[model samples]
Target: MVARERERGFERFITFVDAIVAIAITLLVLPLVELTAELDDYGSVSGLLRENQAEIWAFLLSFAVIARLWFVQHDAVEHVVAHDKRVERLLLLWALTIVFLPFPTSLVAEAPEEPATKLLYIGSMVLSTMLLTHIDLLLVRHPELTDGNGDADPVDGAANVAMLVLALLITLLVPATHYFPLLLLLAADPVARAWHRLRGGGSRSAREGD
Candidate 1:
């Protein structure tokens, strides 16, 4: 009975997290909606889209990022059989970062040309990723928190942290290269795998979470 109740409680927590993530994802598109009001002013719809291409790209980029973050969070939760209060707190913190994303996302949409706005948007993503990494670390350190359903992979966390750190450095060192840091995010997994191989430890299946 106790085990069943614990699982039920964990399910509720996961549901709540999912709801928050869904809301956050929905919020990501809100900034783009305002662009519709000014559509006729651009002479044509296509022209308006073209004129606001930066915002469009920002929206798409942020959407993709948030979607990926949600995936990571959902995947992590699936491994959890029972929850610790610390893990719950970390999950809430992670959700807070996810919710905060839209604010920076809007800043990017409003001032896509500004270095500060771009940095802020990327910085927000980096923070979100870091929080997720911390959660993964906690899981790894406290395997008792999970139900043996999945193995926690810390390499994944390391790769993400490395990627974001490098991205931040590039943004700082090369302000002219707008949005280039985003490319690192896409490369994170491959880079992480290679890192594991070079280290001569950790099986491929394990590194890839297979």
Candidate 2:
């Protein structure tokens, strides 16, 4: 009972953290000036949206990507048991990054045409990936956090590594790609997830036979 209570407390804390991330994601959609009554031009408003289509696309894309990343992070953390101060300390960094990510997401949308802006955006993603790597390293260092002693899903580990590589490659294109490659990630996600699931099932079946 006491153990469950302690878990409840920690789970509540994580929930709060997740809430902050959601709000941060929502906050990225801003500075949309309303069309005034004097400027009752629907055409003008539509034209404005069209002119800033890249920014709008960036906003939507970043929102989706960031939300997906947060969902993954939350799922990973839920299954993980920090085991020691080192692992616990890394969660603090993770939360910090969660808060900081919005700045880059918002910036990317606002300046999609500018190369520097894209670089800044991709830099944030790279930092997120690095932090994600550090989290995985912690999990590796403390194998107790995983089921079947971290060897159960070597394929999943490989998929994550591949995804990290893909992200790093995409990052290189940055503002020069003008969010083209970033948009392409939308297509890659489903395919990668499906491949990962297939590999996981294969690993499980092999383990069962053993």
Candidate 3:
């Protein structure tokens, strides 16, 4: 009976996390939706697009960021058969970052040139990514919380966190860069794979051969 209850609790926790992520992603579009109200000011739909390109870009970027974060979180917990208080608290804090993302996203759209806005937007991302990294590390430390599917590789999360920190630093040092540094995140996966190989953690086939 206790096992059954724990299973149900895990299911409920996962469902709640999914719901929160969905809501946060949906909120990213609300600002764009409100743009429709100013249709008259722009004179035409194309004009509106031209004038509000920054807002549109910000929405798209954040949507992608949140989606990627959700995927990372999902992968981290895919093998989790149970949860503990620490995991629960970390997940809630991660969710809080997701929910707060839209606020800084809006700020970026309104003041793209402000260092403070850049800090707020990218800083939120750093915090979220850091939380995931911590969770992955926690799972590595406490294998009992997960099924014996496979070992967790926290290198990916750590690599991402590093890339984001680099991006944040670039933005701060070069204010004119204007979010371009974020492109560095695209290299995170490759960097992680390289690091893993360097650590003698090769592909499954290589390990099997060994």
Candidate 4:
């Protein structure tokens, strides 16, 4: 019963954190209000927009990408409904990345080409991926938390962590290499689903991309 209460508390906290993350992305666009200076002419306004073109695109891309990552994490945890130390720590790490993302998004929007901003972006992604893989590990190793047959070769958890580490290391290339490994998130889902099917676990709604 105590564990159940803690799990409820954790879910409540996660809901709060998710709401804050949603608001932060919305705020990213709010800063662009400065783009409209004292210019009255339409052509002059267009020029101002052109001058800030890169910032706009960078913000939009980061916003969309972060939204995607957040959704994936949410789905990973949705049916989990637990709060043991392992799950708690993983959720906290996920929350940390969600909270940390806005600052880097703002920095990139202001200076997308700057190395610090780019590295920060990569680091945030790496942290997020690590936490997600941690979730997978918890579910895999602790049969109490899952169907007990969804994961095999727990090495999958290790591979997920290694993939994120490689991507993080490649951040030396800054913004250019930052998103290269993000595709792995989607790819892992199919691979994991296939493994579960082979193991006779069948496809869960979450893994089916619902």
Candidate 5:
């Protein structure tokens, strides 16, 4: 009975977290929706879209970011059969970052050149990724909380954190770069694979496969 209750509680917690993430992602598009109110000021729909391209780009970028983060969080907790206070706290904090993302995303649309805007936008992502990495580490350390799947890997999360940190640095240091530095995230998987190999995880997996 106790075990079942614990699982139920964890399920409720995951559901709550998923709801928050959904709301946050939905919020990312609100700014773009508001852009419709100004359609009368522009010559045509194309003109309005052209003028507000920054807003559209910001919305799309943040939507992708939040989606990716959600996926990572889901993977991290997929096998978790129980939750501890630490995991709960970390997840809540991570959700807070997701909730805060839209504000900075708007700032980016309004003033993409401002170092402060870049810092706020990218900084939120950095913090979010860091929290995720921490959660992954926690899962790795506490396998008993999971189904003994042994599939929790922190390398991908760590690589994502590293890339986002690099992206933040590049954007802050090179104002001309704008948000282009975010493309670094595309390399995260390759970096994770390399890191995993360096740690002999790949070799062990291959040996097991053989």
Candidate 6:
């Protein structure tokens, strides 16, 4: 009975996390709705779209990022067989990170030109990614919390962290062209693979594409 209850509790926790993430993602679209509503009174749709292209880009970027994070969390937790107090705390922190994302997304849409805005957005993403990766690593270490089938590729995590650091550095060094370095994120997998090969380690399949 205790084992079953434990599993149920973990399932409930996962469900809660999923629900929070869903709400956060939904909230990201609200700004776009408001933007459109405001533009409705104005002239041409194309003109309005062109004028608000920054918001559109911000929304698209944030939406894609959130979706990816959700996928990673979902995938990472699939191997979970049980949980403890530590996992519960981490989950709460992770959920909080997800909840906080919409604020930065909005800031990006509203003030993409601001260095602080870009830094906040990128930093939020980095923090969330790091949290999720840490959770996965924790699960791998504590096999009792998960099925033995759980596998985490530390190389991928390292590569992702490196990419985020690069983005952060670019934002700090060249505020005007910070996003240019972020584009390098798309090449993270290749970089990780090359890094592993150079270190005489076998390359593993990437979790997902950029």
lDDT of residue 118 for candidate 4: 67
Report how far residue 38 has shifted in candidate 5, in Å.
Answer: 1.7
TM-score of predicted structure 1? 0.88
Pairs that collide in candidate 2 are none
Residues 60-97 of candidate 2 have per-residue lDDT tens digits of 77777677668556545655533445645665676676
RMSD of each: 2.9, 5.5, 3.6, 5.0, 3.4, 3.6
TM-score of each: 0.88, 0.66, 0.92, 0.69, 0.92, 0.86
lDDT (10s digit) by residue, model 6, range 1-210: 233223888888899889999999899888778867766666778888888887788788878888877876776677786867777787788788888888888787777668787778888878777777787677767877876665666566667778988887887778778466767677777888777668876644433332
Candidate 1: the clashing residue pairs are none
* C-alpha RMSD of candidate 6: 3.6
Q: What would you estimate as the lDDT of candidate 1?
A: 0.76
- Model 6 scores what on Cα lDDT? 0.75
Q: List where candidate 5 sits over 4 angstroms from the true fold.
A: 1-6, 203-210
Which is the better candidate, 1 or 6, if ranked by TM-score? 1
The sequence of per-residue lDDT tens digits that candidate 5 reaches over residues 95-199 is: 999999999998988988998898889899889888888887898888778877547777788888899999999888887888999999988887877766787
Judged by whole-model lDDT over C-alpha atoms, candidate 2 comes out at: 0.57
C-alpha lDDT of residue 172 in model 6: 74
The true-versus-predicted C-alpha distance at residue 133 of model 4, in Å, is: 1.2
On the 0 to 100 scale, the lDDT of residue 101 in model 5 is 95
Report the lDDT of model 4 for residue 29.
77
Candidate 2 least-lDDT 10 residues? 1-10
> Worst ten-residue run, lDDT, model 6?
201-210
lDDT of 1 by residue, 1-210 (tens): 233234777789888988998898887777678878987799898898888877787778878888988987766666777757877888888888888888877777676657677667777777777777777778878877776656566677668778877887777778776677878877777776777778876733344554
